[model samples]
Target chain A: MDHGEKRLMDKNQESLFVRLIPFFERYGILLLILIMIAVLHLLQPDVFLSWRNVTNIFKQVSWQSMLALGVFMVIVTAGIDLSVGSIIMLSLMGLAIASKAGMPWYVVMLVAPAIGFLCGMFNGIGITLLRMPHPFIMTLGTLYIFRGIGNLISGGVPITGFAEQIRVIGNGKIKLDVFFGEGAREYIPTSLILMIVIFFIFWVFLNHTRIGKWIYAIGGNPGAARAAGINVDRILIVVYTLCGFLAGIGGLILAGRTNSAYPNAGLQSELDAIAAVIIGGASFFGGRGTVLGVFAGVMIMGILRNGLNLMNVSVFWQQVLIGSIIILAVYIDVLRRQLATRT
Target chain B: MSDNLVLEAKSVSKFFGTITALQNVDLHLNKGEVLGVVGDNGAGKSTLMKVLSGLYKPSEGSLFFDKEKVTLNSPRDSQNLGLEMVYQDLALAGNLPIGDNIFLGREPTRKVGPFNFLDHKKRKQLTEEHLAKLKINVKSADQKVEELSGGQRQAVAIARATAFNAKIVLMDEPTAALAVKEVGKVLDLILNLKKLGVSVIVISHRMDDIFTVCDRVMALFQGTNFAESELKNTSRDEVIGWIMGKKD
Candidate 1:
């Protein structure tokens, strides 16, 4: 009788552990971030846990997160924007031209995303009207075309001394440190605030809007969406345009932070955005991505980079690790799709 | 040109380059009627359905809706005339929920001054009402299409067509992929569509399905209309023979 009771207790304990495994699976990556932070804190006890370092990471990831979110939408439609990084350069040129022409800071900000919208619109038209087979081809061509255009126009020169408003936008901090008590000297970044606000907007746009659901539908089965009377061409155009628009916003932030518009800005940043989206539990197979998952992905990438830098890791090793993670994430996505279809 | 006729195809022919996919096929469906189209493989049943759905323009002939001479330039033109089609593939987004699939393109919206948002509450309520009317045994309106059985998916497709008040619903091979146990549920959904006063054109190869739910059966053999008659006047053996290219 005593043995039976003991066995029952053991069974109950096993069941509890089994239930916790799902939690681990769901948030195992998050746990990994914490472990990484712990290790980093141990390595750089003074600097890693400092508020300055933490805020710097947030500020750095703010613009890239915008790119990640934008690419997330494009990917949700089973499309890619290889030109996003290149578009950033193009938008930066637009920003420089507008500012140099003595335009208002707000106009300067508008100039970047506006150029992005047009470029994205062109990408959409090329993919749809040109009868291109896939977005991959269309975006690939524009990637080089945009970069070339930026270089031609800017002549490879960098423009600095943006308006005070723009500088604040990129690097200005709101003094919320007083809330932490006297002499805390902590200030929240404007870019970080803007990034979070945009994230909220994107979440609502994807989950609550009609076009958002249509995007998912098109990704899941374009033929079905077309059969259902959706204007598929228009939606694809909208997605590409939105991606371009967001990349422009990133450029705006970039200009503010560096106080300069350089032709080579955001070189290869599109790869980073793609990597972030893939790691965020989104599938390349389309119709399977979440904003929250992508936010986590952005955080993971940002934290990893920050941690590695504090450890004084080589830039090449960082690239190697990020590349490996991208492959691993995609492989996991493929396995997940296989498992989903089997049931 | 009777007032009772909802749709009529007058000697329709479809050619693919040098190959004749359909040759001079004539068909008609009445108000609140279930027409079963039967044929052997490569007999152009799909071609006929596509022509009717306006996915393919008939190479030679005219289409009439409500006895008015009309031309179907595209699927939108047909849909605008209260015509809807549920393809053999069902054309449903498996990742989406039932409500989203039911109202994919024509999602109703609640406009706030300048901004328009999907009226999700209204959508869910209508989806539930339609599913309830069809007596579909899905867990909820929010259930994803991938999670449903083949029968449930078929019911969802029919529900989508009927929800739009489509006067004519064209279905292609509704039961071809369904299991024996699930076939009856699909057939019952078709009956429910009929009971709702909706007209349906069901294309199938199964004689049992035809006799069970369809009021009339038409056969296509080698890209031509071979035979057509009321189900009561025809035997299953005769329809089977008609399917096998045996002439009477």
Candidate 2:
């Protein structure tokens, strides 16, 4: 490889870029988040980095992060779950309806994720057993089917919730009375804590467990994984089920925060979750991604939306921007893959 | 049949509805012997390999391990019987590092309480030792399998196949697309397996590879046995004729 004349010619040019961006290959999104924060702070001055504003950003990012984790798992196995946003709305409706029907708060709280797991199982079974050409067709079909059920169940109206535990998990914050002197009232958001905990547990699951490696292997090459005696169908089912389960969690949090689950809730939120996963550097082609990268991706989206608000950017413009960033992130993934294989 | 034979496939036939992929294919490998299988394209070479590896169920046949009747219902069943296959595509996860790929199905775990976590240190140590023993040179066992050259990828595949104390290895065109030097290395690996008393059945189109490492040769032509010979009693020209449908 070194003997190639082209290698010599490119070495001089490549050295400069390599030297300037040593960590750029792996931690590129983290760097992007930092730069975005810096620019936002510069443009908005006092509003962008204030204590309340920072906490608010984290609060906004929390539920989306959960959905992204689920999507990350599915994407790692080289599959997609466009039904996650739909999964959230359907489960949240179930939670609200159950809570409203005189069921205990604890039961409904646990029920939300349970509903999600079942929905994911549907996706998994449809993809693997039904022999769908690809997961996209199956999940896309469910994206409509699940949302329609939510619409039917909720009668296309909002379902109000009245659970204290739900509200606490979604909206409560632990105040630092002694440190902040009560009047100052600085605190850490519960949603933030939940996000970190969920992310940590899943990071361990994906990196340390044999099942985790098998997921990556399936994504890397399904044929090879099967040839190596790994159960490809079972793993695919597990991944989709996990995605639905997390979407259920996201729905629970979203409903808890709002104190209601609307029939039309989570519209296009799945796209946002997918955007976050892509921005975090998970390849659509699969077999590569990190939880940290996806976290950074969630932050990038959260900050971008918040920063746009602070800078007086139009809500419509933010939608355009976020969609464009998803495309850009995916394009970068393509380029990264090319670069990896080239050497 | 010999007492030393490690594996045998008797009267194996495979059918895909109307098409017969294999018919009455008899194959055997003795302990510590390298048997080369040669055939042209669509000559049931890969099909037989797949059947032996339990990727396919033979329409009619029986397999034997150490002269005992056995059934390979799946890759795991074959694996349980110590039958390992080094696939043509290498069956490696390109996104994973060498150590991870080498230990994909059977990863070492450190039990912390009731939960088990992959023991990265032990895995890396063992991978390094295995690669070193195989003379596979790379910067680190942590290097992604995709980052390696064709030869290096082949080395990783071979390292993985031979790692789990496999009694008999089935390699499908192991040296097909490798470099000249890499081909030599693969032949050496085959010999190394023979020295360890492991049986090998390697599929190849190259007579040079068979002559270099194989103790005997077998040929299949359009899903049936064409010829069989010990290397000492046969010439390259005769083996080439066998692959070209010659008999006796």
Span of 10 residues, lowest total lDDT, candidate 2 chain A: A18-27
- Candidate DockQ values, in order, are 0.73, 0.76
- RMSD of candidate 1 to the truth, in angstroms, is 4.0
Q: For each candidate in turn, give its C-alpha RMSD to the true structure in angstroms.
A: 4.0, 4.2
TM-score of each: 0.90, 0.92
Compute the DockQ of candidate 2. Answer: 0.76
lDDT of 1 by residue, B170-245 (tens): 9998998998999999999889888888889999888878989999999999999999998999999999999899
Q: After superposing candidate 1 on the true structure, give the runs of residues whose Cα lies further than 4 Å from its correct spot.
A: A1-45, A177-184, A331-343, B1-4, B13-24, B59-61
Error of 2 at A42 (Å): 1.7
Candidate 1 docks with a DockQ of 0.73
Put down candidate 2 lDDT per residue, A185-250, tens digits, no spaces: 688999999999999999999999999999999999888787776889999999999999999989
Tell how far residue A28 is off in model 2, in angstroms.
Answer: 2.8
Tens-place lDDT per residue, model 2, B159-206, is 898888899999988898988878887788788888878889999999
Highest DockQ among the candidates is held by which one? 2
